[model samples]
Structure formats: C-alpha cells, structure tokens
Target: MRCDGGKPACQQCVRAKKSDGCEYDDGKGKTRTQIMREHIARLESRIKELESPEITTPPITLFDPHAASPYFSESSSSSSHDSPGTTISLSASASPAPFPIGATADLESAHWDGQWSSMHDFPAVPQIGEPFGAEDPPLELAQMLLEIFLPHRHQCGLELHVGRLRESLTHPLSEQRHPVLMNAIYLWACFLSRPGQLYEHEGLYLSRALAAVNDAIANPAKAVDFIQASCLLSVYFLSNGRLLEGSYHASAAASLALQWGLHQIGRDDFVGSMSSERESTFRLEPAKDSIEQGERILAFWQVFNLDRCWSVALQRPATIPDSKHPWTAITTPWPQRMEDYETGEVDIGPGSPTIHAFFIHQAQVSNAIGGFSTFALHAKAAALLEGASRLSSSWSPQLSTSPSLTDNFRAFEHTITRFTTSLLPLHQLSATMPEDKYSLILIHSLAHASMIRLHEPFLDDQVSRDVALRAARSVTVVAKHIADGDFDYLDPLIGHCWVCAARVLISELAQLQTTWPPANTVDIRGELSTLLFSMNKLSSRFPLLAYQATKVQKLLDAN
Candidate 1:
C-alpha cells in the first residue's frame, strides 16, 4: 500500500513518498514510531552519560581513561559528580563500551578455567548506614565478592555477564548503575562471607535492594537489571524466612517476564523494529545482542525455577501457571556459561539442547540429562521434590478423608523411585565430574525426603510409617555428609530436607518406649544430637534452618 501513501503496498503506480515511513490514518502518537522514539531517547541518554566527564566521580581510578574508555580516550576531570566530599564514584575499566553493539569481548576468567580460587579471600564487609547513593564498594572488594558468589551462582540463578559487570562497576553512575542488583549480589557475598561479615552489612544491602525492587516492580519496563535483581532478592528473602515478601518479589518477576515477552525464543514485542541491526541501536553497551538475549532466557528460567521451588517450599500456588502458558512449547535453549555467551561461543544449533528438555521425561526415559550435558541433577531433583511437596501441601482435613490421595502418592512414588534408580553409577561419576557426586548426593537424599513427604501424612498405617521413617533416617546420614563436604553450598531446599528429617526423628522420640516396644531402644539420642548439630551448622547462613532447628530444640526440651 506504499504505492499510494499506504502501508499494504497496493497494486498501483502512485508517486507517494514512502521516506516518511508510512504513518497510518488511524493513529499518530499511539504507534511503533513512538515506541522506537522512546528507545532512541534511552540510547541517547546512555551515550551522553558515557561521554560526559561530570556524570560520575572516581573513588580510586582503577584504570587510565585512555586505556579504559571505549569511545574517546581524552582524560576527564577527576572531581566528584556529587557535592564535594559527600559521595564516592567508580568507573568501568574495559572502557565505556565493553562489547561491539551486538557482541561481547572474549571473557577469559579463572572461574570457568581449570584453576579455582578459595572463596574465603574476600575483604570483611563492615556495617554501613542507608546506602542511598553511588558510594561504590571497592573494585577489589567487588571482584572478590564476584569470586565468592561464583561457586553457588548456578543455584542462586545468577547469570550476570562478568565482563560487562566488571566494566560497569569500574565507573558506576548513580542512576546508570544497577544498584539494586549490585546490593543483592553483595548481600549474597556477605552471606557467604566469614562468620560476622554477614550480620554487619546484610540489612544495609537488603534495605537498598528492597527499595529499588519496589520501584522496579511498580515500573517493570525499567530495564533488564530489574528482572535479575528481583530473582536474587526473592532467593535471599526465602532463604532467610521472609516468605511473604519473597513470594511477592518472585511473583513480580514472573509478571515482568511475561510482560517483556521473555518466555518466547525470538520475541520482538519490546523491540519496535524487526531488524536485529535496528534493535542493537538501543543497547547501552557493546555486549552482543546474544548476551542480552541469553540474559532474558536465563532470567526467565531463574524466575520459573523460583516459582516451582517456592510454591512447594511455602505451600502456596506458583505464580507462573503451567496451565496457561506455552511452557511445554518453549524452544529456548539451556543457558551456556556467561563466559561462553560473552565470547560468542553459544552453541544453540542442533548440538545444543533446550533447558525445558530436562522436564520432558523422568531420568532414562528421555535423554534430556545427557542431551543437556551441563545440566545439574541437584537442580532437577529439587524441582521434582517441589512437585512432590506441592502434592503433600494439598492435605486438607477434607482432602485427607478421601482415598484419591493414595493413588496420587503411589504414582509420584513410582516416578521418584525410577529417577533415583536411574542415576549414574559411582564408578561413572569421577573426580573430573565432581559436581556429579554432589548431584547424586542431593538427588538421593531428596529422593528419600520425597518418600517421607508423600507417606508421612498417612503415618497411622504401619507400612506408611516404616517407609517414612526409613527415608527420614536415610536422608539424615546422607545429607549431613553432603553438608560437611564436596558441595560448597547446599540450596535452601536442602534445609527443607533437614526440617522434614528432624520432624520424623522428633516424632519418633516423642513415642519412646511405646513406639520401640521395649525391644529396639538402641541409643537414638546420639542420632538426634547429630541431626541437631548439623542443623546448627547451617543456621548461621540460613535463618529458616535456624527457625526449624529452634522448633526441634523446643520439641526435645518439652519431652
């Protein structure tokens, strides 16, 4: 219709200038033109911020401007952007642009390489007042924090681009900086830090993060950082017993994920134009289009994982409803390492597998595990336990009176049994695949935990009591060893496992001679002591575990 000043290209030779870009007769300001203009304005602001010398202040110049600035290399004034002596600032070391418009640099860090550093090397995080502005934490401290969080990043659903993160923090502006996400990251770092480091700054970081998260939730179209920030905050809150708040943030992330079209593989609703080249124009930095795309995929998966896990953990319905979305039809591939995405090593072709493939079938029935080689069985097992937990949480006095629950438990029991039995043999899981051993530990322990969850409700039956108690003791011994060994950090699901195990042990102890029948009163007090001690070990880091431990202690004291 461009032939006669129209959009549909009508079959007529008319001298209608298409250069003005085909405005329709229906609307003027309410079109893609306006959306594109908004994007352009954001891009322009980003460019101006990077170019302007007075935009951010320097704390301790990490790198020379000539070497660091991606654009012009001229040295800018060193004066603080804020009122003199009132604020601190930082700058990105890799230059204003860390990548070419559509791609990232070769991100080579020791993290993904063969060599690994001990996470204990981070500087102690001292207490700070309300962290209101860009008083950037030291560059060394930031790198150390990044390192400390790396071992547990996969479990935490953190998928930030290391190269870009490093550059952005090196020169952080007040608004340009993703302070909320930064605070959340630091909160985790502080949590994992040496004993007292956590208590000192956790509140400060959390206060700032929560405030920003609230703003982002109110206006989700703000930026990609909000999604990741919300995901991290949700995890932090849940791990520390902030259930209601955590669920709110997690649900908010889910809403934003859908609104931003993060669920689809090639979604362009946010991008006004169809061209990748045109879309790249909105980018704030040079990190590739793939980096942004990968972030969206990873971020959405993070939210999805949270929805499933917490729905079970908290005994609530999931925000990401499986019945409504094309979740099964999602073709998005599993997330590669951030380094791989940054360096353009993303293998999304026939060779690479989709993350959703992990849920298609149970264990050996489908080759999704091997199909997605980077897949962690602990994460998979956690998801299955969540499913079982969801079923267990359905126990109402009315529902409990019905016989249908037995059939449901039986079906789920068979599924979990098959999954546990199908695991790789010990000989197969070697030093090379160290993660496999931990995965096996978690899967096996949680599988036993699943049996308890499914059967404990019907404990009046001798068979159900035996099954639940057997699984309870099994997980206790196995989980204690896992907590003390190979895995650097156990996810919060593991704490829930401990909670269930403690309940069974405490309930059995309550019955004493009647339950034992004066025949098998073997020294069970020692076992109870061991379980309580193990729970104590984790309580310092996870307050929910502390709460569970306290409940158990009170029970034992009462008896």
Candidate 2:
C-alpha cells in the first residue's frame, strides 16, 4: 500500500499503530511553486527523449494525397520510419495526445491500420441567419411581439432604452445597435411570438441570435450589452425547459458581471480586446451619468436573483453569493420603473426617490421582514425560497439522524415561520379579485410552494406534514383559479412555481399508497386532476409547464 506521506506517520502506518515509519524528505520544505518547477523540468526531459526521431515505434501507412476518393482503406503491413503518411491509426487503448513542440503528428507512437471512424461524430457548424432590417420579418408581427415582451421585460431584467428600441424598430436604422443585443431581443420576441406567421420564424431568429451571442462570448467587453443579451437568453432557455442551456448562460452572465467590475461601484474593469487607448479612456471617465450607473446596479441584482433561484431548482451551488461583493462598495441604488428613466424623474446617484422607488426600497431593506407591497413581496418570496433550498439540501439522514441535522431543520423552520408571518393582511393575496388576480395569486402560491419544499423531505413529522399539505392545497386552488379565469399567457417563472407545488402534492399522494398519510390528509384526486389539466393547457405556450404536468400524470397513473 502507498501512503499519502502525511506528517509524523503515514495514514497506513497510523492505522497499523506504527509510530515513526513515514518519510517525505523529497516533498517536505519546498513551496508549491518550487515543486511544480521541478516536476516541469523532469517532464521537459521526458518529452525531449520521446520526441527524438531516433526513438521510432510503429510505422504508419500514408494515404495517397492525390487520390480522387475520400476513402483510405489500403494499408501496408510493414513500413520504414521515413514513410509518408496522411492519417493516423493507433491502438484502441491509446489516448489522443497533443503534438509536442516542433514535432509532427506521426513523429512517434503511430500505427498503420485501416480501421475507420465515422464522419458523423463531428457536427456541422450552424448557419447564421440573414441580417434583420425593418422589412425582413413582417412589421405587424414584430410590433405584436414587442408588445407581448414590454409588460414583462422588467421582470426578466431588461434595461435597454425602450424609446431608442421603439425608434429603431419603427424608423430607419440611423444609429447602429449592437447585433448581440438586437438578436437577443429578436430571440425573446420569437419566444413570446404568436400567430402562425410569428411562430414559424423562431428558428430564423434563434440561429441569428446564437451566431451573435457566440461572438459576444468570445469577447464580452461592453458589459452592458453583454449582460442584457446573456440574461435574456438564459431566461428564454429556462422558460423553454432547457435547464442546462439556461444554467450555462446564467453562469456566463454572473462571470461577465464580476469580470466587468459591476460588483465594485466606481471601479473601472477593462475587459476583452480593446486597445490600451480605448481602455485608458474608460479608466479616465467612469459612468458620470447616473442613469447608466443605475442600470449596472439593477443588472447585477437581476443576475443575483436568477443565480439564487436556479441554484435551488437544479440543486447546484449558487453562482453569486450575497457576500461576493460587499454592500459598502456596491452602492448602486435599486431599480425604479423604466418610465421614470424616460421621464428623467430619477437621478442616478441617490438624489430623490422616483415614483417606483418606494416599492424597490421596501422589498430590499436589510433588517425588515414583513408586510411589503405586491412587488416587494414577490422579491422577498424569491429570496426566502433560495434560503430554504440551501438549508434543506445541506443535510439528509443516510441511516439515522444526528444533532446537526435536527438543528438545521429547526433553524430552517424558524426562517420559514419568520417569512410566512411577515406577510401582513395587506400582503395576503385574495383569490376572488376580478381584474388582475393571477399575478398576486402566483406570488402567494410560490411562497407556499417554498414552504412545501422545506418541509416535504421530513413529512413523517406532523408539523412538516401540516405545512406541506397546506402549501400543496394552496397550489391546486391558485392553479384552478387561473384555469377558471380567461388568462391566455402565464409567466414562465410562475409556471415553475406551480410545477413545484404539483410535485409536493403528488409526493403526498404517492405516500398515501404505501405508508400512513397524515390524519388530516384528504383524497384530492379531483383537485390534482384539475391542476394537471390546467398545466397541460398552459404547456402549449410555456413548454416547460409540460414537465410538471407529465410528472403529475405519472404519479396519478402509478397511484
């Protein structure tokens, strides 16, 4: 057995009750850099030996360079070192290694067999779409998509100047807009687009958006445009049930936000391939305009919220921790309404509150906990869910419980109680509202769903069962309300929360089949069926909604 060469005695020696058998004279007393340099020196000497022309191994057969056919099946049994070769055929066990410095592919370790690999293994490059001008995709359809997008844009973190965007779409393109951002907008439009004509062009928009986005990733210098494009793309992916793609873009956005020094207010972080002169220009002049600076601030939190939400859904670590950037350096104020910016009501550097400032401020206060407005409540709900997810996943009993696990559970419940109680009478949503009940109901449903997630894992406990059952029932009721109403479009994030709620209900239902369910549990197969029907209907527009619907369907079938 080999020891890791621990100090005093090796692990093996320690286990065997030996006192002084360990030795690391070679590794001890050297810094990591010194050890790495020594290792590199040895590797360099080995590479030189292997790369020598005199060190010959298997002889490779050369495919005729002048051959008309692409197929190369002919092989010579034996060949000399100087034989001309076009392709390599190594042993199946041999790994693909990079060519040594100043060495040819066939310099060493090449075999001359005629075995073939399929060309289909390599995917063809995707083609980019033709440029979009005013006349490309019909005007009526573009306008409709923009309308479908605008009302929901702020919720998804769009801070682009709407007036400028409106002018570019309606009037001639006098000033150039960034292609990455332009295509990203077009992509989101395609996502929300309707009618046969609009829906058919999603492929066209996606290809164009992807082409520009790839280029932007290669050099994401202009942080504002890059952040917008990436965040929008991530939201689109998440809406469509493309979680991996969403996570990738979310990570990219977080990385770009940090790299751009958005975390550090008043600091210049030059990125990408800009010349020293251009970089120096940015360094000399920070964002003197408060509007631009505030956009960056809002943009940072937008990514932060996303990072927190999806981290729970995907059961992965969060990308942007709250402590990643201290609050002292990050002094960009919370976002106000986009209209406030257009009207020039809210100044950038903390002068006076805008029309929407109170809502933003209340939702974001550090010490306060409850009785916020509808929008502020929604933001807090998101935060609470994130906290619950992190705490819940931290501990699970492999065989039996421990003090740490029990303590974590208690602390987790305390947080849930605190947040749940914080919702004052004004904050409580009503199911009977006539005009616009869906948004508020969705918010409450999501908050309850969070309660379910935190308590669902420990449903055997009576307290946890009660909380989870209540949350599960609230989800079904809200879902039924939406279905009963004539709402055509559902927010994708709300769809995600409904899915979480359905999963909670379905889990309890599944439990009833085997173990003894809670005494208060009722047979709500009808409720489950209604919720499923609603989800199935919503799936036509929101593709990810189908995921929850299908899962519930399977559970019903199994039961």
lDDT of 2 by residue, 168-285 (tens): 6665432334446666676665455443233334545554455455445544344666677788878776665556667888898887776665644432231113223333322213
TM-score of each: 0.63, 0.61
TM-score of candidate 2 against the unseen true structure: 0.61
Candidate 1 structure quality by residue, lDDT tens digits, 1-559 = 3224344422332233222334334443344346544654454344234334365554334333223322211322232221123322211111111112221121122221111132222222333443223334545555555555655665576665666666776663533436567777876766665353333456555654654554454443344688888888888766655566678788888777765655544323322244354433233332247676667656766776677666666666767543323332333444454545666655442321233344445333333322233333444565567767777667765643557876777777877777666766434443223343555665666777777877767676778787888878877667555535454455665666666776777667666656535635354556667667766676656655655565566666665
Candidate 2 segments exceeding 4 Å error: 1-145, 152-161, 168-177, 214-221, 263-290, 324-334, 339-376, 399-439, 483-487, 513-523
lDDT (Cα, 0-100) at 181 in candidate 2: 65
Our model 1 lands, by Cα RMSD against the true structure, at 19.7
Clash number by candidate, in order = 15, 0
Error of 1 at 48 (Å): 34
Per-residue error (Å), model 1, residue 365? 7.1
